[model samples]
Target: MIALTSPLLWYTARASGIVSLLLLTAVMALGVMTATRVGGRPMPRFAVAEVHRRIALMTMIFLVLHILTTVLDTYVHIGLLAALIPFTSAYKTVWVAFGSVAFDLLLAVTIASLLKQRISHAAWRAIHWLSYVSFPIAIIHVLMIGTDTRFPWMLLLVAGCVGTLFLAIAWRLWAHPRPDGALTAVPRRKGRPGTTATASTQHAPRGRKIASSGQTRKPR
Candidate 1:
């Protein structure tokens, strides 16, 4: 339990908010990179995915603490319901609504992710994209509601998070576009391996015709 008059509570809340933003940024960046299968020797695709998941869990923790501290602070009129319900806060109602919106979206994304194994992949994926909404709303909340936004360092931080995510999304779209006539996987027979040709292969060379005797018949 944090003391209402303690400056430590205020500082902790601010720090947690900043950390949550950074973690959210990392989660989003790595998510894009993972979806695009971006990786190198030092880090593989699986590693990127693993890091993204762990960071998401951590982001949730910090976010909880941030909300707790905000509710605990006597300096603000923000209440518990305000955190859970949008536009209920008496202080900075509009800007705080952004946080509320982002929080709800992130909560949905997290819950859907936890039940991913039980749910259809398409459903999980559809809800998981709410993180995209969560990120921008969080960024906007921080920018408009945060006391540090006037500082150059904070501005740079905001710019960096936005710029990096924007570039990553652009790169992902450019690298993995599904334009018409895009090259798709070479379809394999239903029961056949999709890899190298095998003895029971069905596909043959364009001009070749195999006879029942396993001999190439003349192209008459």
Candidate 2:
């Protein structure tokens, strides 16, 4: 017969899973903002990127805690191997498998990030894309097997996370509107009859050094 464990372990596992989800939500939203350069002079782009990294680290930590507690709790048959290998857990096999898959993807992403300097940029970016796939799988795992999902508050929390991430993506697409995410060019300005002026050319001060027709000259 399977031995029963203390309820504390169960509670801890549930709590850690919830916290991990919340942290993951924050990390995803911040990642979008970071990519889109949403921060202004006060926050700065680097600051936004740094915050995203810190929260992602926290999410991984809590995720580890959740897996450990679930394995230790004897209420279910989830073992250490079950935590890492998909479809191996006897309890809610499919749901647990989803969590395992998500974890594997997250682990890949984390390792790629840590070795970003050593790896080619294309490889790193490809690995990073797995994070987007992992996030939705993790959410599905939570909803499928989580006992708390029966509660209204838990459902609302999940909805909010999904909403926040979607909003961030929408803003990024709207502002960038390009695959490279470059800023749009400013409109050209008209100058004298035979000359063309752009925003840059119009702003030039008089007497700036220049070469025209192979002769050293200055702007009028």
Candidate 3:
């Protein structure tokens, strides 16, 4: 005997979920770009890293809202434990467990990032790898949930997300970087000799202790 307006809760949950997915997409793309150290003319490498962090934070915010609204809605019975513990929910049990798994991985990534300074680099990176796996698991969770999959637009959205993620990963892997990301060695043509004389010299002018112009030359 619930009110008609309860649909609003479900709608809010759906919207937040989609928004979080988009934010996660941006975060993943930015993270890949950060690794490649590539950026647009206006956005530098550091800015890319900064935007990645900010978008990840925003993604977490929307994710929290999505989880809360879904649990709070009276239409479905999603307990607090279902959100934290996998395979414990009675509703869409398997799909919900996937979401829960993603949530758990995300929690680890967030905590590890916050404690980065305290934790060793290898440990932090090991925990962060969960995020890459979590992204695809979340997509599968949504697809299997049967929420918006019936709509053509929803299918297109999921396809776009998958395509974007694959392309981002490909670019990240294909782009090679110079050692230390620096082009220190000068390039030469195929027929170039052992060395070429440069116009510039490192030698300083011997002015201070030199003999005057009128001074006679001494035999060495």
Candidate 4:
């Protein structure tokens, strides 16, 4: 346990926590962009979605590192239980609880996304919305408990992240309004036989036939 008291661990915990927040903010922004189908001719929609997925993966990696380092750092004596359970940490109870809750929500959303193919779209979507709740709580957690937040540069970083996320959300809600007032995947256009060919055959007179070429001809 004494080995865990290294100053390196403390710095790693702080740096990883901050990076995780930044990555999570990017993920949220990209999610909003994907929902609104923001990328067009220059950047395809699929590319935006792919970027969102990759960034989300990176966010999870950094978050896990943050959690692990924080818990292992002997300076604070934060147990694994306190890391996972809300309102149980001896140090900064309320702020730690907020972090715990946000972690739980993000974990659920990640699991739901992984199993998205097996779950109902409604179920996946509902779980996914938890991200919105988790993010603000996470910001609160950082503001209340983070030691580095006192720095002006850190404050500006947080502000910029918050501003970017809000701008994306506002653009999504106002510029891309949907009938249900929810962000959803754009419906895909299904390919089908030529409209004119299908129409000509379906509406052919009783004595006429639709040739293979889709032209009307007298019955043989």
* Candidate with the larger TM-score of 1 and 2: 2
Q: Candidate 3's residue-wise lDDT over 1-220, tens digit each?
A: 4423388889999999998888888898888777776654567566788899999999999999999999889687888888779999999899999999988899899999999999999999999888999999999988998489889999899888888988988977776642233111232233323222322111113312223332222223
Worst 10 residues of 3 by lDDT: 195-204
Over 4 Å off in model 1, which ranges?
1-3, 177-220
Candidate 2, which segments miss by more than 4 Å at Cα?
A: 1-4, 177-220
Residue 8, model 2: lDDT of 93
The model with the greater TM-score, 3 or 4, is 4
- Tens-place lDDT per residue, model 2, 1-220, is 5675788989999999999999998999988877775655467566778899999999999999999999888878898899899999898999999999999999999999999999999999999889899999999999999999999999999999889988888888776733322222333455454343432332333534334422222444
| Candidate 4 local lDDT, residue 13 | 92
TM-score of 3: 0.78
TM-score against truth, every candidate: 0.78, 0.79, 0.78, 0.79
Clash count of each predicted structure: 0, 0, 0, 0
- The pairs that clash in candidate 2 are none
lDDT of 2: 0.82
What TM-score does model 2 achieve against the real structure? Answer: 0.79
Expressed as tens digits, the lDDT of each residue in 67-140 for candidate 1 is 99988987887889998799999999999999999989999999999999999999999999989988889998
